[model samples]
Target: MRFDPQPASYRPDPAILPLAPWLGDPVEAATFPRHDLRFRNDRWARAVGLAELSDAAWVDHFGRFAPLSDNLPQPLALRYHGHQFRVYNPEIGDGRGFLFAQLRDGDDRLLDLGTKGSGRTPWSRTADGRLTLKGAVREILATEMLEALGVYTSKTFSVVETGEELVRGDEPSPTRSAVMTRLSHGHIRIGTFQRLLVLEERDHTQRLVDYCLEHFPGPTPPEDAPDRDNPAVRLLHQVVERLADLAASWMVAGFVHGVLNTDNMNISGESFDYGPWRFLPKWEPGFTAAYFDQQGLYAFARQPEAVQWNLGQLAIALRPLCDAKPLVAALDRFGPLYTAALAKRWCWRLGVAPRGEDADARLVSACERAMREDGSQPDAFFHRHRGGRNANDELAEALQGYAAVEDEAEYWSDDRPETMVIEEVERIWAAIDRHDDWTALTGKIAAIRRMGAAHGEPPVPVGHIRRDRT
Candidate 1:
């Protein structure tokens, strides 16, 4: 690993440390028994200029937790408080993971290198701070599929299998262990602000607002915003727009995040921390991803509601820095914004140019009704009707005058669309577990990317400013 030549062209930026000590606690990484490289995301690695790192160097920094130059000197377990399943938990923070490093991509956008299953932190409570190999594999699959479906999500950068047998109640006994690194736009969550509010750190909260505004630049505040120029109000409005789009994307993609806690809601609006997530196998509104979510708080159809509730929590957290009226006004935009996003995304998925709002919504309703009547999965339904083909009755009438986005694509001719349902995920995991084979997993990722390419570019998310340097 030649550090002088900088083969990776790394641009390390310790962007989070300025809010540190109070923001998080420096912690040591756990000593793993082995550092066997299992997975490497060369695509994203190259995007961030880390593709040149030797496998040994990759393991040294990510698996062994060596600090990158000009990055964080040590892993910092970020402090946060979140409402877990609607119950406030002040003891929670970075239990099994920490922000490892921050850097810039080719576009000069700040990116975070965060870890999962790295080690125990102050927030570990009584649970072991380790991730099962199965868990890591699932996250890789989740991020890849979600990204392909155009959700702003984290990238699973690396997965190093540690030779440690772990016991997990959720899975089989003596499961394999591994540490996974995620590449994301930012690590600041709504819960980050919640922690500051609980501690009455108004000044620090204001600073955080400013930092987010500068780092994750978004659209200007609404003209009717009570305090259009106020940083706090602007941040709230931006978050509302992003999360609304996020919720719509998930709904249209037929994906369930499973966990929609306040901590899981990132300020930058990128989705991360995939635990027990699932893509819809059928158009079941009550379909759930996590077995523990028996109450269906974050169910398939309830995700939008859950997101709105979480945004309300963020508004409460920001109350110390801004007037409640402005925050409430920002929050009220969610319903209309989400409806528009749903229509836009629904049309995009169907590979047709969107019609007027009413027509698009009618088309979406007809499509959903058709799915329910036929009991078809989203993958089958979307593929069967791409470019407005194979439609009749309400769907056909609603799709009138909608032009196809493209004349033809090779993927459209395929017999079946790629899907990431639980059965397929388990099949890939089973190959790795029983036969130590990775071909199935890699093949699925490739196919997912191809499907995404066939769909063409997704709708640009609202409130996200393009920051790439030309």
Candidate 2:
């Protein structure tokens, strides 16, 4: 599909006010002559007021890596530290990518245009900073599927295939190269806070808290709470709630993020930076996505624990600004909050109206038991029984009190539900590799969207409701 930018509703607002203190030195993007724009997310473009740029302009900005006129004059390679597999890695940062620009969405919320496979930077660390086209394709698939499943995620805004052959240890040698951009709420991460703490920059830590509170405020803290007015405590509470909901969403969608490292965890609670992600074929907690994860530290069932541990690191980072006890209090809420979010998400995915906390919990348990017993594909299982249909004796008992919220769609009438299993993904990629056929990928995306529409929107995170109690 080709697009020409018309009179764009484009509104550029470089609102990363904290960039001055948080960003590292500017870097130049590698200029590739072939700016073959492969993908443009028009849905998100319209939402961001950028639905109208000419094709040439789009390529110039996203493909050729030209600086946006009113956006950041130069790409800022953001500096931060993160723990890789529970090991502290102070050397970690934006090695291959940088923040391209920032703008406000139609909702006036700040959004970031961050790059992947753009070029090398100081953090590149002796490695060429180019992304294989297959890697970019995988990210597109990951983000698209996650969004369809109602996970708050980054949107792959643009992808341009650069004419270069990259050799990689994984995948075939001399794979094609590409540059892509992801539009996300904010790039601030749990690791971002860790960097501040490591530098002994208590004041910067407080500034970062203020930045998050102002830009990405969550439900207000309880009015009677000791740290209700404390921005640090409030931010911690908000991160916990968002991350918990994120973890639950992944579980309900049967997604394994593969990497739950601190650097990959966005503070805005949006999931991005997809790598080695997978959707489970059956209900198995020990399923690991990455080949390198021999220890299964980030297995499907352990995702909640991994995320909570990351939250703990974030809490520890907040110690410079607030009493550790208040942060602990906020951290303590993660377990119950995650449980509530999981139940709500599970009900939504199953197309059932939540009867109540206890009943919903029972329904989730019953669904799990049914899936395990039948050894069913997660997506198919949810698609088949959506709205409480085709339930066996066990599931019927738990589903008795609840009602299905969605009507059956035509897609469900098919013999099998559309799924993104590993083999199917490889089949799609093989077509691209051999014949440059994008039909399968595009068709699969459309099917996934239909499945999402069949289920309706997911329920809002339970922790989002504010309990003021003044």
Candidate 3:
């Protein structure tokens, strides 16, 4: 689709005041010889009031080095330390990218415009902070697929091809280069809080907590909640709940994040920093996405544990401001929360209204057993058996009391499910690499959207059976 050349309708509204005091060292974006704007998300742009920008203006704001009006005058490379694969690294931060700007979305939620492969910062330890065009494409695919599957993830706002040849050991040497931006709810990570603890900045930690509570507030705590008045404890509970839902969402979608480091865990519970991510071809607990994850530390099954561990680190960072008992209690709720979330999401993916807690649990177990016995891919399995219609005897029996929530659609008539396997992704990239062909990529995105629409929104778990239950 072509971008509209009209003047932008919406004015810029910056809301990053809470982070002003703690802003890190400012940095400049790299001056690329080429600024080829390849992709622009018009849907998201409209939501943010930037849909009407002319092509040149779009490139100027996203591609060129020009800063957004009323936004940050200069990019701020945030400071934070994280545990990479279980090892604490104090020398970590936004080495290549920085927080470019913050704006309110249609929902009035604060959204951050963060860059990847922009340029080097003080944290760029001996490495060039460049993002390959292939990496940017992969990120776009990852975020799009995850969003269609109902996962809370960042939107790949724009990808501009930078005129530079980058040599990397991963893919072909001297690969094409690009810079991308992500629109996320917030970038305040678990490691962000950890940095305050590392610096012994108790006052700063309190300020950060208040900022999050005000800007990135989560569900309100129960009336009987312990230390509910304390922003630290409240943030902890909210984060735990969000992370638990995230873990369950991944499981239902058959996605492996590959990297579950503290820095990658956003306070808003949205998934970002897509690297070495994968959609499982089948139900395998020990499946690992990244080649470097030989030990499967963040394996498919271990993701929950990994995220919980990261939460523990966040709790540790908040220890100075809140009691330990309340934090531990919050952490302990992960399992139950994950279990409940999985059941609800599973029912949604299957196009079935949840029967009840116990019945839905039994249905989930039955579905898993069927998939394992049949050796079917999760995507295909879910697509074929939506509403528990085309299931085997066991799954059929388990889903007997539940009814389908979605009506028949064109996507349901397709011979195969739309999947983002490695092979398919490579093929799409090959078309782009050999010849600047975006047809395949665009087509795949359309198919994925169709599937998402066919599945419809998740049904609320009502104990009473629907009259339409077949």
Candidate 4:
């Protein structure tokens, strides 16, 4: 493939370095035993102007952790504290991953190339910094499927098998090892701001807020918002808006993120760090993704509450910079925003034109009732009743006057829609682990993309730069 020579292509912009010692620490990549390039996202590569690299070059950068030209001279392990399971922990940070590179995408949106299993940093504590090959494979599947399902998520840009045997309590011991790279909108988390708050670094917190507002532009705060022009208030407003929609998107896609901690919650509102995530088999409210989540803290139906709570933590973090009243007001907007977003996204998945919020809400409720009563999986339910074609009494009434978005895509004619439940994921991984086959993974990706095409363009994420929604 020919590399695009446009200036926007390969534009390395390491914007985080200026935040220096206070933000993170410079670190070295681990010396791996071998480098085997496994998965390369050529589609996103072309979008970011890295499509021209050969397999060897790809491994050199992602596996060996070589610095991208014009990017950071070395990897920087970010520092942030988060509330893990409602308990505040100041010890956690980027123990396993670091920001490898930063650049703009084709749309001029800033993106970060961050690594998982690259190496240990100052935050390594008592854990190995390497990722299991199975973990890498799971992330690839999670990102691909979530993207197709219209969830704003980090893209698994590249995966390289680092020849190493690692032991873990959760998986089989001495399993295969690999390093995966995530291409995301930004790596700034609510915990990033929380770190500053803990240190009593008011100026640094304000600077970080300014950086986020400038880099990830969002809609201006409402005219009635207290301190609407204040950087801290504006940033809070933006994050609240994006995350409300994010929660709704996940709900519509039948996804349970499993963890919604402050550090895991990206400031840009894109979902990342897919650990123990799952899609619903049917409409089960208490379904949890992580096996250890015994309390069902981040269950399927409770995701929106988890997100709203995280946003509240962010507001707490920002109190040092702005008045608490304005931040509280911004946080209060989450409910309305989430309600509207759920209606819109739910309608999108059903392939019906959305009416006003009240009508759309009724349609969503009816569909959920039908699925729960019929014991139908979400993937099957949506596909079987697209445009209200096969709806029952309640759902049919709710779908009245809602014209279907015109599309002749063959995926719409399929007997069943593609799903990424645990069984299918394990089966795909079994093929890769036993026979060293990648066809199953590749084929599933292709099918998922076709499904996304039939759904058309996803709604533009809030706070993202305006562009063609179609």
For all candidates, what are the clash counts?
0, 2, 0, 0
> Residue by residue across 1-470, what tens digits does model 1's lDDT show?
00111224578888888889689999999999999999998877876778988999999998998988878999999999999999998999999999999998766678889999998999999978999999999999998887777777888999999999999888898989999999988889999999999999999999999989988989987687898788999999999999999899899899999999999999998888999999999999999999999899999999999999999999999999878899999999999999998999889889899988998889999999999999999989999999999999888988899998774668889999999999999999999999999999989888887776677656766557332112
- Write candidate 2's Cα lDDT for 1-470 as tens digits: 11121223557777664555555668899877588888888867776676687788888988877887788888888889999999999997888898998886545577789999988998999878899888888888888787778788888899999999899997889999999999888889899899999999888888888888877867876675568678899998888889889899999999999999999999888888988999998999899999999999999999999999999999999998888888898889899989999999998888777787898888889889988988999999988897889887989988886876747578668788877788888998899889999898888877877766665567665444211100
lDDT of 3 by residue, 188-238 (tens): 899999998989999999988888887876666657778777889888888
Backbone clash total for model 4 is 0
Go through the candidates in order and give the C-alpha RMSD of each one to the true structure.
3.5, 3.9, 4.7, 2.5
Model 1 per-residue lDDT at 301:
98
The residue ranges of model 2 lying beyond 4 angstroms of the native Cα positions read 1-8, 462-470
Order the numbered candidates by lDDT, best leading.
1, 4, 2, 3
- Model 2: lDDT equals 0.83
Cα displacement (angstroms), candidate 2, residue 75, comes to: 0.8
Report the C-alpha displacement of residue 265, candidate 4, in angstroms. 0.4
lDDT of 4 by residue, 84-146 (tens): 888899999999999999997766777899999988899999988999999999999889888
In model 4, which regions exceed 4 Å deviation?
1-8, 461-470
lDDT of 1: 0.88
Give residue 270's error in model 4 in angstroms.
0.5
Q: How do all the candidates rank in terms of TM-score, highest first?
A: 4, 1, 2, 3
